[model samples]
Target chain A: MEGSQYRGYGMILLGAVVSITIIRLAYVLYWIGRPLRPMPKHLSTLIVLGSGGHTAEMLRLVNVLQKDRFVPRFYIAAGTDNMSLQKARVLEDSLLENKGIGNKDIEKLAYFEQIYRSREVGQSYITSIYTTILAIVHALWLMLKFRPEVIICNGPGTCIPICLVAFILKVIGVRWSSIFYIESIARVRRLSLSGLLLYKLHLADQFYVQWPQLQRKYPRAHYVGCVM
Target chain B: MEMSGRHQSPKTENQMVFVTVGSTFFDALVKSVDSQQVKDELRKRGYTNLLIQMGRGFSIPSKSSGEDGSLAVDYFTFSPSIADYMRSASLIISHAGSGSIFETLRLGKPLIVVANEDLMDNHQIELAEVLADKKHLFCATPQTLHQTIRTMDLGSLLPYPPGEALPIAKLMNRSQNRARSSRSLLSPPRHFCSNNSPFFFVDVGFTVQQGRTGDSFLGISFSGCVLLLHTARPRLWILLLHLFQYISS
Candidate 1:
């Protein structure tokens, strides 16, 4: 009688694990299998900016975007980085001027948010584990708050947590954000750490490489011919 | 200020060579450019003025004119309007940061990008080499910079192709409209949400118009076209269903 009871308990536990795995797999397939369709007139976009070079490259990309279509833009940067946010504002002000609009109305069409940095340059790996959690929590809060329809980012360590949160939201059916990751032009022969993770984990919807050799190494990434 | 004291009055026809290491300290590049050999090469190339943005480097060269006072030497740690300096330059020798490289290239200035070898990641060298191979800019290391300056033909470098973002924008738009699922029966739905709604609306409508809930939502043009309405809240779904039925009847 004791043996029979133990077997029954084990079977129930096994069954529970199997069913949960199947459901999770279904959700993954459901989201990943989505087909392309016609875009709407306007989309809420999230642009993740980083310090120095990353911000410069991203702004160059933003400069060429269709202004009217990608409205209500949100620019996310690391909390420690003031320069990127300042640069973004300058770009926004210039964009407003081009549209013949006043600077006072800049907040209505564009929003800026700062997320905690997961790890600082040259930070020890052990301590970074703790900071990484903090960054993820902050990212989750921002993701839930905005739930943007489109997300575009270049190679930035700060972008990793936000993109991860976006993927989690998709899994839970909270929001389906299309993630676009453009490898930094500085990364000619190999992808950066952030780019490698997103590519390996399939977090980015579309991965673009500026160099053709990098595309050959990572077949999944699209070679867009030096998007600088 | 010393910055103003070191400067001499500029001649309209004077050609200036701008050396920048951006926001980082690159003592090697600064020292190389400050060396006598490099100064003589610039003079040979007909450059009359040398302006160096040294960043945080330790090797600050003393401000002194050349033997003939034909070549003026000036150095500053940082500048807010570096682009103005770049614009007036006849030649630019910049560090291999994409920001500095592209900025100089777009200005159509003759550039020689020097890669910092001390940095752990040497990937920046690849960018410099590729651009050099295309004849867009000359590439050199700190040790070889003088050689590059002496031998590089500014006229041989071609203009970098202007960057285009339209392809990425088109890709983003196409990705935004992707269908919700693989099932043919479950076709793509038009998303409807506004600041007022706590949750986004993924309504399966052949033609979707907003209801009374949010001003940003589509106004009701045809009531019967919405086949399904999916929302994060069940209460909102029932309310929307009732409103749709009320409009149709």
Candidate 2:
């Protein structure tokens, strides 16, 4: 009788473990394969602005966004890149002026956040590893505070960490934020390093390529036709 | 017309050649540009001024001031507004960085991109190859830089068409509508935090020190009422249990 009771207990424990494992797997699959809902109107959006070309491309995209729909917009750039910050501010001022909005309202509309510079495209491996780790930690903090509903980025090394954080938040059942990855127009023949990562990991909700050839190569990627 | 013609004279005009190595130290690029052969070639072409924005690279042109009015080379460690220099430049030679390439293209200036082979992953070579294939710019190595510069057909190169700025608002609306109607099941989650009350916050600090080593440090801190909530009330435990159940389900 005692042996039978022990076996029964073992079976119960085994069943519990199996069920838990299945549940976790199912949760992951649901997140990975769920239907995309329409982006809610009046989104608190976060835009990651990389240095130089990345910044210019992002600014061009931002200039066309319905500013009223993306209320309280937040911009993230490298801490060392004063030029990018200045450019963002200048763009904002010009945008406001075009809308007939005064300078006094600028403070109320947008906020610029700075994170540590990630490894540049041609930087050494060891140094890049260290900087990438730092960027991930900083990106996590930004995500937690900003609580952005929609995050958009073009192909830049800096976007990788932030996208990873968004992916993590989704896995842990904190749903609400979506990442949109747009490959740069310069990437005509192949996807950039960051673009490849987001694609392989299934981190981005919607992935776009500027060229039609790329879209044909990666059937999953949408061809948005050069949004530089 | 006479005044304009005099102003445009090759001897009186200073044709600026801007050499930029971007933020990283590219000693090879600096060395190639400062070579005796390249200098002689520049003088032959009537290029009077060479303005170099040498980043962390230590090499300075040996003949800084042109002897017998050959070529006057001026270099600075770095510049905040290299655009000003680019605007005045008749030709640009730079390390194969995307930023430098894009900026030069935007200004419709003739350019030669020198690949830094020592860089990790051979990215510069790849970019240079693409740009060269497009006929947007010339690609050169340190050994071939002089020859490439001498033989480059600037008139035959294609002008890069500037991309039109996208109208994001209209695109966003169209995308949203498409997403809503589509049966595709791969959308990102919409919310992460369930509680309306602010329970967590994060602080970040970063510093970048400029030098050959280029040391950078990042600090992050997480603080808020979440920890206090765990201890403050017995009812919180039940709520937490329910929340976990909700998430798992």
Q: Which candidate's DockQ is highest?
A: 1
Candidate 2 Cα outliers beyond 4 Å, as residue runs: A1-35, A116-137, A184-190, A210-217, A224-228, B1-11, B165-173, B179-249
DockQ of each: 0.35, 0.23
lDDT of 1: 0.78
Winning model by TM-score: 1
**Relative to the unseen true structure, what is the Cα RMSD of model 2?**
12.5
lDDT by residue (A29-49, candidate 2, tens digit) is: 444423345556677788988
CAPRI verdict on model 1? acceptable
lDDT of 1 by residue, A22-68 (tens): 66546454455243334567778899998888898888888878778
Give lDDT: candidate 1, residue B195.
Answer: 21
**Clashing residue pairs, backbone N/CA/C < 3 A, model 1:** B209-B218, B210-B218, B210-B219
lDDT of 2 by residue, B150-195 (tens): 7777766778887654544455545554454432222222112333
Which TM-score value belongs to model 2?
0.74
